[model samples]
Target: MTTTPAATPPGWYPAPDGSGTSWWWDGGQWVQPPQVPAAANPTTLARLALATQILLVAGGAVAATTIAVEGYGVGVASDYLNGNDTSIALFDLYDQGTLVGSIAAIVATIATAVLWAVWQFHAAKHVAGQTRRTPGWHAGSWFIPIVCWWFPYQNISDLWRAIGRVRPTWQIAWWVLWLAGSAVSQLSSRVYLAAEDLEQLRISMWLSIVGELLTLAAVPLACLIVRGITQGIVQRAATPAHTLVA
Candidate 1:
């Protein structure tokens, strides 16, 4: 009688093709993960992630400011409807928010792209160590159809294990919140843009506020993961192999 291969353990597994890059086994083998390319130094990737986190914080603050401005405008409208002399123009508050928010949004977008690149590259490098991965595959995996999600997740998982780091409970929570936030933000932006009245616009803004809150909650967790991974690898590099083996 023959027996099946035991389910892969929850850790980084060698690539089926003998490629230096590896896949993360999430207590199961649901799909094959793709590879990344040669990349920047791991520290550089960590720094890039840090920079992105800063930009994200600024973006979150700007988003909160817009929410406050919108909230105040609603009060002004209530004042106007009460038949008082309309002393303040709510449009001015909206305009201010639009200006600052737009700039912050642009910065956040660029920062996010940089963060993603660094993460993928670092993962590739972590897996291959001295040999490393090809530069093209690491940077281009996200754009590949159907492979993007699995590839990145596996890379990050492999990276955590390669560095001997533990996956925190908050890690999964952050991802759930991050995905939820992104989805809501997109839907909210569409609603806000298509709104024909102040009430509709305010409702959309509130929805956006909720999304931003979720994203903000996730950002710090992400930063923690980046820091932990980098620090772990640095220690591993400094420690002699004999000591680790003993």
Candidate 2:
């Protein structure tokens, strides 16, 4: 009779998923792995995140102002439709603000979106060993169609929990507001594009205003999340694996 092979001792091994991170193999089962210090520092990416958030806030303010000016244009359009004399100069000013502000906001949003993905990619490295998700998920999740809504939020939550902390309320608040705002903004854009009269346009502008405000409120929470996670990563980098409570 052949003897049975000896059982493997408990230890860390390369993750089965091939995520380039390790997993803890307890004698009989796979369990939570110890924290691995990140090879790269996240401090630089954190600074970039802060700058992008500020740019987004400024862009949002400009967009809100533009929408307000456009709302005023609804009155101008109404008066012109009623055969009343409209101030051409004021209408021109509104047009200029709308065109310029919209462009600025679009540029800022595109820049922030691209850089935000980069930031997440780098930040995820800190928790690569702890999170079940691949590091790429942090950045890719934001671009995948319908899943983008929930996946990015989950990725962020995972990153947070990976650091041995409970999900914060601000994170929830930020995601909810971000989702609602995006939906409302899209709805407003469609309504505005389809508007046949001043009343419809006014409703659209109201929707846009609401969406912009909600997004603005979420900006600070997003920044806080960035700051919190960045600090956590730094702290984890310093704390030895044996000393970690989790």
Candidate 3:
């Protein structure tokens, strides 16, 4: 007696015999097999973050240099305007130099803003694996005009909340450092701008120097915070699934 061939699976193709060729399964009907794309390498996100941070740092440095030159130029200009003969000649040279410095500073500020935005975007994308939702909104909130001026503090608060969600007792030393540094920097800028006498200028300059030092300290602290957060995320992601045994 002759035996009948087994039926081919619904989604699969049949053998090339008069039997049946393997069927290509399409969405509706059998078609060619689909190719699956390879997953992205996780290290790409870290590298992107590093590159962004470097760009931001470089941009900030350029901007700082420009601001310093501008301050020096303006100081010389003020002295000349106040009737200092020596300062008059110095002002001429600084006037030209300051024009160039101002342009460079503007470019650097723009570069820093762009790099920071990219950095925040990549960070939000990468951190999504750890948190249930994206934190991009927090980054965007910083650019909202009148609201943006005060939002830095709120952003820090929200960031702390986000961190608390991931791990209890996440030290807020960096946040405090950054906030204090920023406040001091702003105060220094205002003081420098409002200085009337030579004594006031001297005091403002010292304050500005202190503020800058605080800012320098805050940068490393911020870096450390980012590193800690990333490590925490990786650890959380690497946790193995638990099996229930009877």
Q: Write the per-residue lDDT of candidate 2 for residues 134-229, one digit (tens) a residue.
A: 888888889899989898998888888987788897688999988998889889889989999766876777787788778877877887887777
Q: Cα deviation in Å at residue 88, candidate 3?
A: 1.2
Off-target runs (Cα >4 Å) in candidate 3 are 1-41, 63-71, 74-84, 126-133, 146-217, 234-246
Ten residues in sequence with the least summed lDDT for candidate 1 = 237-246
Residue pairs clashing, model 3: 13-22, 13-23, 14-20, 14-21, 14-22, 15-20, 24-30, 24-31, 26-31
Ranking by TM-score: 2, 1, 3
Pairs that collide in candidate 2 are none
The TM-scores of all predictions, comma-separated, are 0.67, 0.74, 0.53
C-alpha RMSD for every candidate: 12.6, 10.7, 11.0
Question: 1 or 3, which is superior by lDDT?
Answer: 1
TM-score of 2: 0.74
Off by over 4 Å in 1: 1-46, 73-88, 129-151, 242-246
